[model samples]
Target: MKPIYKRIVLKLSGEALAGEKGLGIDTNTIMRIAKEVKTIQKMGVEIAIVVGGGNFWRGVSAKEMDRTTSDHMGMLGTVMNALALQDALEKLDVITRVQSAIDMKQIAEPYIRRRAIRHLEKKRIVIFAAGTGNPYFSTDTTAALRAAEIEAQVILVGKKGVDGIYDSDPKLNRLAKKFETLNYIDILNLGLKIMDSTATSLCMDNKIPLVVFGIDEPNNIIDVINGKKIGTHVKED
Candidate 1:
């Protein structure tokens, strides 16, 4: 099957990497994700990844800690997740590179835009970590920023349980409405939980499309690439 998108930025929440336990790294789950990623790469699609740190730590949720310190810790968590994913992908015989926003030469290469794009051109999956190398930004913003830097065709948001953007929290409100299609302005005005405002605004201003879908099912990443319409699609009106 031909892929609809030639290049994509996959936004994965750290919680999604935690599997059913909802904490830390899940080896089996990471391996499963790696296999799926491998499948998509084989389709001749350039893949770049931005992973969140919600599973290991949340900077905003910790009231006692200094905001910057907490955020830095969160960045570190993302790096750990990045390394884990790198290992999983490498084990699958997929050439992968981990680039950290914050310099960690021993483990990950420091993020360089031209170098990252070069890696993608060579069919290597690049995992971006450390959340923009700043304290206040979320990984969602990182995904948007990286997508723009790499000129990605779209951003594929791989959510855990929820399949699409809803008017309210679907987990809490069973009556929440699911939107199959939406515009970026609607997302910001309606305050949907699809992504942080910064990330949404970035994609909107750049006119990058987004596909939000569940990662629980097999070959979901592949399905999204093939434009199977299994999730909410946000784009310009």
Candidate 2:
């Protein structure tokens, strides 16, 4: 199917790349995600990716440690994931670029809005790294920030545990109501925890659609871009 948006930011959890064991990099999962993104790119959709580092590390995981140090550690983990994704994407014949929020000249380009968009305009997949380059902020917010800055049409969030946004935790409550479609107010009121509040507010303020879906399913990114309606879509009023 044809993609719905000309440009999209695919947000993936670091844990999602860990596969079933939930530790370290999962090659199968990474390859699957790469192929899915490639499918959309083949159909003329410009893809930008923001990968989390929860699998290897997360700032909150080391709550007992100094917040700044822990956050920097988490940011390094994101760079590791970003490099892995860049390798996978390039292997699949997708022209790719990696721009780090924190400068790493040898490894990636520094995050420059115009340069990243230029890469996309030239049909290269841009992978954003380093998670907003700030302590205590999540890669989720990085995705939203980059999406907004790049003027992406939508943020396709591939979740690890849940299929979509629900009033309550679906696992905890079997009868938890899932919304096929939702608005920012629903997320704000329910505190759905789909994306961080910062990320949600960023999208809401910019009118960028956020589609949260299960990443466990193969080709899910392509499925979302293809307009399959496989997950909950959060939008602005």
Candidate 3:
């Protein structure tokens, strides 16, 4: 199937990479995701990924720790995830590059907008790490920022468990209704938990469309890009 968007930023939560274990990277899970990514890459779509570090660390969870320190540690965790994902993709013969906001020159290239775009133009997958090199910001915000900088057509968010954006937490309330499509203002006003307010606002201001969907099912990424409509699409109404 043909991909609807020429370029996209895939926002993956660290928990999604952790799979059922709920912590740390799951080999089988990452491999499965890598294979799926390969499929889409072969479809001639430029892919940039912003992976979270929640599997390794979450600043908010460390209530007693200094917020900045905890957040910095969280950023390092993202770099680790980026390397693992880069390895998995390379093993599949997909050329991938890891760009870190917090530079580790020996391991990854520093975040450079033009270089990233050039990599995408060359059909190389670029994985962004380190959460904007700032404390208190989330990987979701990083995705929005990078997408806006790279001028991507859409942000495809692969959520860990839930299928799409709901009126309330589906796990907590089974009766919660799912929204197939929503506007940016609706997300802001209703305060959906899909992405942080800062990230949501950035997407809105830039007019970037987003698709929030479940990552559990195989081929969900491919399905979303092929326009099967398996997720909640957010855009300007």
Best by lDDT: 3
Weakest lDDT window of 10 consecutive positions for candidate 1: 218-227
| lDDT tens digits, residue span 30-60, model 1 | 9999999999999999999999999999998
Structural similarity to truth (TM-score) of each candidate: 0.99, 0.97, 0.99
The whole-model lDDT of each prediction reads: 0.94, 0.89, 0.96
Tell me model 3's lDDT, rounded to 2 decimals. 0.96
* Clashing pairs counted in every model: 0, 0, 0
Report how far residue 140 has shifted in candidate 2, in Å.
Answer: 1.2
Kindly list the per-residue Cα lDDT of model 3 for residues 53-99, writing each as its tens digit. Answer: 99999987899999999999999999999999999999999999999
Clashing pairs in 1: none
All candidates: CA RMSD in angstroms? 0.7, 1.1, 0.6
**lDDT string, candidate 2, 117-168, tens digits:** 9999999999898999999799988988999899999988899888888889
**By lDDT: ranked, best first:** 3, 1, 2
Error of 3 at 116 (Å): 0.2
